[model samples]
Target: MTDPLSALEAAVQALPDDRTLRVRYAELLADAGRHGEAIEQASVVLREAPEDEAAKAVVRRAALAAAEPPGSTPAAAPPDDRHEDIDWSELEASIANPTEPPFVERVVAEHDEELVAEAGETAEDADPVAELRRETVRLADVGGLEVVKRRIDESFLQPMAHPEIAAAFGKKLRGGLLLYGPPGCGKTFLARAIAGELGAHFISVTLSDVLDRFIGESEKNIHRVFRTAREHAPAVLFFDEMDAIGAKRSGNTFSSFRNVVNQILVEMDGVDSQNDGVYVLAATNHPWEVDAALKRPGRFDRMVLVRPPDDDAREAILRVHLRRRPIEGIDLGDLVRRTKGFSGADLEHLVTTAAEKAMTESIRTGSVRPMRMDDMRAALKEVKPSIGPWVQTARNVAEYSNGSGEYDDMVEWLREEKQL
Candidate 1:
């Protein structure tokens, strides 16, 4: 006689709408220790007929079984059969009202009352610098971009490391450093590495961390960020997307935005030039969009261009992304050669696409398979280099707006790459 579970699986495959068959199959899968498959089967039933008690019970039991640690006997289902793995409350609420939005689309709640550090303190009043952390990544962790690294070392790291030598030579370990490059080129990562090299705490601030809906709140947030860094002396306060926060005052329509920019200018200089130990680092994809005042002397005067990863960096990125996934016969050197001009993010997407293709094949064949070279080749065809438009824009800027020799380095790079 044909095995009952196998027959049911085949039957369900043929008639997928058979709710009764799927529930029974799910139960059998749970009994056989295939809890993941069992939960999937039961979830399908719940989606269609959410009030189905039997399907709900199966899901609860299977989810609980799946959460159990290996080598431990499965515990009996409790009266409520609630499992922490799945949000049962949210699932039931969604089932009750199908019009409700999914969890991903739901808005996160505002900062809670407990986030108030003191009585009568509002959300905006809270210290926005709570995310300060010690960075372990150094320049060595960064694979390529030798030119960018060298610029950082000579300009920032070396001076801080040998302060005595720098003072002797009349070099000040002050002034903001602005890193301009295409997006996902590891500017933020490099900033963190610089902080680590200095053995300082890293505090990264983005647009959301500074911008507020209320008037005067945005400027307050900016002050808070600098104040936090000052309190934690020898800290690196990194602004991830400086263009958004320090947009050109002339271009901004809102007075509030101009005020925010003015506040940033004031804070960067610090009160009585007390910003000795607080290192300010900012990154922007569009340096041309940043306010000219912010880039003036005594501000973000020093600038570095972080271009896309080279061959070695691309290979390192691919290896990192694919380390956990099962892969076969992948030529790292060939991949690196082919992925020229690809950013770190683009390489990660390529790996993800290849893994997804392998997974789809595995699902269709009912057997797990490793990502192969063919999968990677197919993925490469689909995922083109995303840095083309950025490069073109940079080239145009280098050509037209580089009268002051500001973007001379970019001009040199464009000519070197024959993109000019």
Candidate 2:
């Protein structure tokens, strides 16, 4: 005789993609006065299906219920008029034509979904590590970022490739490289390419793979991750969002995460384990937010700035995305010239939007139509560069807080782009 609520919770955990199961579990949680859990479950549903009115109601009601003290009756709340002026039709259209899928979707497509489970919960018995025994994408596959590739070759790839030469030069295969850039700029892709070059196993980890609600479990998870990497020696362990996992420890709000950072530092330094052949790589949009200790010598000591694609890279990205699609009259040169500040992901969205337009026209005409330059031009109107805010933030850091000159690469990029 299992408890119904417990059984339902287990089922939802097992099949997270089942929207109906999630909604029912949320409802039961709300009924049981577990408002906080209800809100979390409902929010996960909303993230996947934004138009789920039932999940939205559960969130609103559970939130209100949580505000009341135990044994106190909740008073009827006033209506929320915050969005009364919003144009419903326009909003719906925007939702339908999303410039890009959510971050969760992008990461899940490339890595393990279990690695991105909701905060403060562990994906029980789930192996989130995605190990690529032989990576198919090499540095040659990367469209641009020649400067980044050269830096990696000099610092990491060459040494790993010619161990005898490295030994003769007294260069130990140690330390990690941090790739910082605007979101959707192919940092993860670059990391995979590095692994391909090294001809090693690739494992990408995110915050969800390490954090857990139980005390001491996070530290244990960090150890487990390193151990797995060591077992597959000649491996590349990439941490996607380093800032969240290794935030500055000075803040009281992040005191709980301090141990996690300390554990990472210990593991990176190989204090209690043999990290001889394991290569560590990390990427973050906010390098300034990462723990300063993690940037110390022999850790993520070297940082590289991966900027938006240049002309050649843009053309290559466009061709790769459109090669299999039904397209015609696509002037790659013109499209590349027009998309000056677009990141790799922005270009992908541009192509996807163009394809969607062609699909819509086909539906209306009852005949398949090839995606044309006009369709691309129309998509361009809706898809703007998503890297502006990040560039502005980088400019602020390079100008005001760069006493150590750690962000010199970013400063040089800002000047080249006339943003300084």
Models 1 onward score TM values of 0.71, 0.71
Give the Å error, residue 393, model 2: 0.5
Candidate 1, overall lDDT?
0.81
lDDT of 1 by residue, 288-377 (tens): 999999999889988999989987788789999999999999999889998988989999999999999999999999999999999999
User: lDDT of each model, Cα atoms only?
Assistant: 0.81, 0.79
Off by over 4 Å in 1: 1-126, 169-172, 270-273
**Distance from true location, Cα of 42 in model 1, Å:** 46
Query: Among these predicted structures, which one has the highest TM-score?
Result: 2
Residue 37, candidate 2: alpha-carbon lDDT: 77
Q: In candidate 1, what residue range of length 10 has the lowest lDDT sum?
A: 97-106
When summed lDDT is taken over every stretch of 10 residues in candidate 2, the lowest stretch is: 98-107
Choose the strongest candidate by lDDT.
Answer: 1
Count clashes in each candidate, considering only residues at least 3 apart in sequence or on different chains: 0, 0
